[model samples]
Target: MTDRRYTLSKNERLCGKKNIQELFNEGSSFYFFPFKVYYSFNKNKTEGDHCALFTVPKRLFSKAVDRNLLKRKIKEAYRLNKPQFYNIPTSRPINIAYIYTARKMLNYSDIESSMIRCQKKLADNILNAQNDEEKN
Candidate 1:
């Protein structure tokens, strides 16, 4: 059987000042076509585990239904694509926040494609960062 690595929770989310600041200050980021990801390096967290924070602005999605729909799409995409991160060495927990930048809503296929691309970029970044650290 295949093991699952990524999971989202209320407390583990990047909600507070410290976590958010760390992500902005210490973490590296990757941007895909439709999503911008901000992630932070951690030394105390576990390997092969992740939590997500998603934002769908009211400015872009005026109605609650629209915002909720977008959020649901993003979450579903993340859920399916999260296993890709398992290949990276996870010494610490990484906090990832996916901010939607598109002006219009996207279909599931588009979201899924974007998410897969985003996850691959993130994995590449992590691998490169680790390699750099090892070389230094």
Candidate 2:
């Protein structure tokens, strides 16, 4: 699916225990509605770029089924809207984690729009970071 780069590939997912730990411990974070996005950027290179992890907190969602449902919705939203970040004019290879922070479960559309906003904000953040470096 060369034409469809939006497909969530294995490489495009935030894997490995080390990678995840680094993101959580040292990455920057921001909140967008039901999602709390934690991200780290490696601005030296663009290749091997942009991996994501979607999560539903077990503390808020007691049931496994409920957590799974939320994760699926979040994944779908990210997959559909990720192209916005893919085309960013920056050298950073971004690693992000989307953790569902809301206590109540929201339906698909709410999650989708929030995901869109999150991606847009990420793009803006990248642009701002680039601009900051230029000014420095």
Candidate 1: where are CA atoms >4 Å away? 5-12, 43-48
Assess the local accuracy of residue 105 in candidate 1 as a C-alpha lDDT between 0 and 100: 90
- lDDT (Cα, tens digit) per residue for candidate 1, span 24-125: 788777678788888877545665356578888889889999989999998888876766665566556778889998999989999999888888888888
Candidate 2 lDDT over residue span 27-108, tens digit each: 8898889889998885434676588999988999999999999999999998988777677876667888999999999999
Which candidate number has the best TM-score?
2
How many residue pairs clash in each candidate at the backbone level?
1, 0
CA lDDT of every candidate: 0.77, 0.85
